[model samples]
Target: MTTPVLNTVLVRCSHTYQDELTVGDTKLLLDTTFRPEWHRKISAEVVAVPRKLNTRHTAYRGLKLGEIKAGDTIYFHYFGLTKENRLDTEDQDLYAIPYHEIFCKVREGVISALNGWALVEPVEVKSGSAWIGTDSEKISTQEGILRFIGHPKTDQPALNVQAGDRVVFSKNADFINTIEDKDYFIMQQEDLLATQPQKANEIESDYAGPRHYYETSPFYLSPDHD
Candidate 1:
């Protein structure tokens, strides 16, 4: 295998899923298995690294992934899934991705947000069926409960808020990921506007009213297909 150079890191993608295929004239329906969005592979093992840095690649100097070493399992961006980035070989599923595209190391048994990124669990409301941001046009009140906080990096500084803090972040942030069928957003720590520690009484829970005792919240969808 050829070593990547000039801040380009080589990696073999973990695994992604698709249920349908179109070849020639047939539309094939594959397995009916429903894999949650998190199960979709986004982390990959670093196969090779550049020997020398490029003068123009400032991001390669102090990488958030820290040294961008080989054998590191890191989460990266989609890179638009361009054919130019992928090598369609007979056996190798290799991708030559720029070092900047690699986000952070895959924290074992946990989700790790690195380089000033925060993993946020959207505050559930309306009987725990709807999300806080889903209905509110008001950005001030929109909030998320932090699940994991990233470590400080060279250019990416750590957030003042810790895990479990309720935070209202700026509208400039946008990125939502589904883990175990639940939604979480990964936004830059600098985007946070205000923060507060989680309170017991103010703890977000399934909203319950007298009517909820007899019926489900309108946002709910039963596992049974209707």
Candidate 2:
């Protein structure tokens, strides 16, 4: 019998032959044989966010429909696009939207997005546990990317984090470049400094900037005065 692995986070790997598959004999084969069956297994819901407009700040209209369950992992595939091959000028500019902001649905481990971006099931971590176990032999980091070492104990409340929280960590550039199949990393809770909160209002009201700037900026107001 095959041994069952618990707490394994699975991410759908990005594909490479997107352009080739869309044209010539490959396209003919896929249309007749593969496309019909593939469409049956997957469904896609397009998000209605604005593309290009004359504005300095990008406005996020948000995902109006669909939902991602607790155990969903987001997969991002970045392809720097230009007008010569695929994207138009306006379409290319729309790509500036961050990957995390884009949302989609994947059902039963089947990916729905043919554009190479999809969300996989998230890995559930047990409550009160700081360390995430990984199957890798070593951890690596790229230059200019910050990596933190988490405290073994939770004595410091600063590093305390909840399970299923999205975290930002510095990744090993060399290792990532060398290994095409590897996914996920092991890290202590303390090593991570920031977590993406579920809501904007959940952010704490602490200021770490200069007092003068905090007092003068129009965005900031003193709570004590009010």
Candidate 3:
């Protein structure tokens, strides 16, 4: 006899896909994956926030950090567009699946914007360099191109960069042999999940010149006289 697993949340499947699925769908996916009988309990809430513009296709907007407190209960599903090619005996056609499956929480909701974060900076290449794109399109120089790194976005899949992989950027810089490629930019830094240091003390650049010490101070009176 299959022992009935006890759970307080009930999840249902929804045919339609929405940024925020119904609460019912949330419970169903949880039941299948997060075996409540054997795993520790985890929960959170879904709160909406401003969406970032020009993000990846799968990256939806309106998700904020701290949407759910540490112990609040919540459920979710994957929401986005997908493409699939298939050849079959019954029918020959491509199957594009826009699916939403329920998912239960086994840990804290730490992936929210408030809890989750990112840092973006222009790519850096020297004034002159030679490089090639994963597409084999040779970049001769760096001019109208920008390179950066952060949480993997849906855009620019050719980057093939991982959490620690170096991100390189290149554009069509030449039309002849030994294309005249210039270094545009590079986000050679590691994953920026937290605050980024604008200036480091060890290596000082002109960009980090000493301040006048009055950027935020008003005219000061003489020390001897008020």
Q: Return the top candidate by lDDT.
A: 1
Worst-scoring 10-residue span by lDDT in model 2: 173-182
Among these predicted structures, which one has the highest TM-score? Answer: 1
lDDT of 1: 0.58
Give the residue spans of candidate 2 off by over 4 A.
1-151, 154-158, 172-183, 198-226
- All-Cα superposition RMSD per candidate: 8.3, 22.1, 21.3
Of candidate 3, the 10-residue stretch with the lowest lDDT total is 175-184
Cα lDDT tens digits for candidate 2, 72-101: 433232231212223233323222223223
Clashes of each: 0, 6, 17
Across residues 16-84, which tens digit of lDDT does each residue of candidate 3 receive? 222221233342122223332222211222222112222233333222222322233333322211112
Q: Which candidate model has the greater TM-score, 1 or 3?
A: 1
Candidate order (lDDT)? 1, 2, 3
lDDT over C-alpha atoms for residue 101 of model 1: 59
Model 3 per-residue lDDT at 17: 24
In Å, residue 54's CA in model 3 sits off its true spot by 16
Error of 3 at 39 (Å): 45
